[model samples]
Target: MSDSSTDNEASLHQYQDIQYSLKQSNRKTTSLFIERDGSVTVRAPLPYDMAKIESIIEQKRSWIYRNLAEWEDLNRVQVHREFVNGEGFLYLGRNYRLQLVDEQDEALVLKNGRFLLRRDHVDSGMEIFKNFYRTKGLDRINQRLTHFAPKMGVTFGSVRVMELQHRWASCTSKGDLNFHWRCLMAPLAVLDYIIIHELAHRLYRNHDAKFWDAVDKVLPDYQRHVSWLRHNGAGMGL
Candidate 1:
């Protein structure tokens, strides 16, 4: 609970641009977290010595290396689309290259197994693409929610579409279902699985056995879709 490092003679307290604190936990080991503002904090038991904790963190540098490598891999694979020619987009779990064209009206046309973005009249091609997908995505989700919510004997107050960074969909205690707009890229069955998963939460808030049982009552093979989302979710992000 006290600072034990006494190598410095200037002052007992050392000034670091980043300060580290050790927290007491029930776990046998320590963990480190780098905060958003570039501060590093280590969590460990209160009885542990500061010098030993620092040594342990140094010994676990391999974990830091692994995490940095994962971050770099995610950054490399997460592609951002510009809604321009040659940009790749996903529809129904398949990839298609965007082909931009000058036309009288803004439209999304599919031809020759490619998505054509006719963006002559649209002020912002990206906005047009987003709006188009939003509408279609909302429609599909609404249809699935309506069909599944009733079967699960759960009534939802509202369903809304928005962009979520961390989750594909979430359900609030008030019976509202919120889905990410990027879910449009998934297949209809996959989207339905997410909807059903959220709707079941209306009955059981946490992912307990009862919740999973409720989900299995509706979707017998929900694991496959869940696995697909977990593995390929990053590519769905903008």
Candidate 2:
């Protein structure tokens, strides 16, 4: 496979103390992002020049630095796990030890406060665990959505739990919601926050004041969960 982009040309550009990749497209507004790996990218309208893009970057300098610092802190506690007995895995913010069983009809099951895995599936344990999360996540997320949708005054389409990479959850233009399977590893409250965050997107596409206000109406103390995910996200992995 090869990489191709018709919307924008990517090149490394620097302004003062900031170095970033500028992506200009037909977008109506310029948006900045700190990628999952901590690289800076700015997407601006096609008509904007380098000077204008740099100015936008300068305006958001403090925000960029703050999020980059948090990204650094997140990576510091990155977790490494092995598919052996007594190794702990996270489920709803709780740690459950792993136990390999010689015989089981299913590849994995949570029983007696521990995760029981079939011994033969050790090599493909990651996918098995992801399947477990995705399966369980769909039921839980849909249930929560049902409870919260009316409160938020929105009707959603289908809900799915899959690999969303760096994002916790996303809402489509058609009102469908997709969540990362890793979300099932967080606390129930945090998971609700994730759901509400996406549901709010059903009303507003951007993270503006109105979008946040919609979230505040449902969960008053949502910032703590945001901070929790930022601080603890690294450990929520295989």
Candidate 3:
């Protein structure tokens, strides 16, 4: 770990086997989370007490363990990408391999059971792929949200597709929707889940019981999609 991460990591108890990352900010509440990579994090108000934090961790031990187990299971499925010939790419729930060709008007396109790309643009293939998704995601996500928003009782004023570092999608307080272009690679059902998730946030603004209930009303099998994202998210990008 770097010095900054060392600053972030701490122990619940000095003699215990478990370690957690600590982040102190001017937040309203203290929360513990397990990241996709299976690392534990504790976010708290500034100037927190060691004993109080330990007590909270002790109380939520069961929830933490269960979530950690799920994380391990999801992470156990290896998902990675390689920039080479015949490399597989995911688009709308289907896998397509790369087929480099010398003649292509566009930078990239999906055709005949493969992603056709210009041989000269192989060095920039990842960007071309991202642009392909970004271009398609704009229309696809917008259409889906337009179809579902009225039924869900949420209206988004605008939608944008771009690169997101930490989240699949987000809804702004001003009623704008932003989705990561990578989301276009997931199954349509999973994409719906992501859309519903952001839409639900427009109403609740937090992931509480009410938010999940809203999601459940929209997609009853939302957990399956959530699990799919957790397990396969590692491979969604180049």
RMSD of each: 8.5, 6.7, 6.5
Provide TM-scores for the models.
0.66, 0.73, 0.73
After TM-score superposition, the amount by which residue 164's alpha carbon in candidate 1 deviates from its true location, in angstroms, is 2.1
Writing each residue's lDDT as its tens digit, candidate 1 over 1-238 gives 3445333221122123123545555677777764333234566654655677667667655443322221222232565777767878887687888887777353776678787777663346666666766787888888888899889998997777876545667788898878877778888788888888889889997655788789889999987776666566667754
Worst 10 residues of 3 by lDDT: 68-77
Per-residue lDDT tens digits of candidate 2, residues 32-91? 887756679988765556677777888998666544433333334657789999999999
Q: Please identify which of the two predictions, 1 or 2, would achieve the higher TM-score against the true structure.
A: 2
Candidate 2, backbone clash total: 0
Candidate 3 lDDT over residue span 1-238, tens digit each: 2223334445342315346777764576888777665567787765666677677788877555434432333223355666577989999889999888989899788999999888999888778888999999999998899899998998887889998756677678998988888789999998988888888888897555787789899899887887787667766776
Q: Cα deviation of 107 in candidate 1 (Å)?
A: 4.1
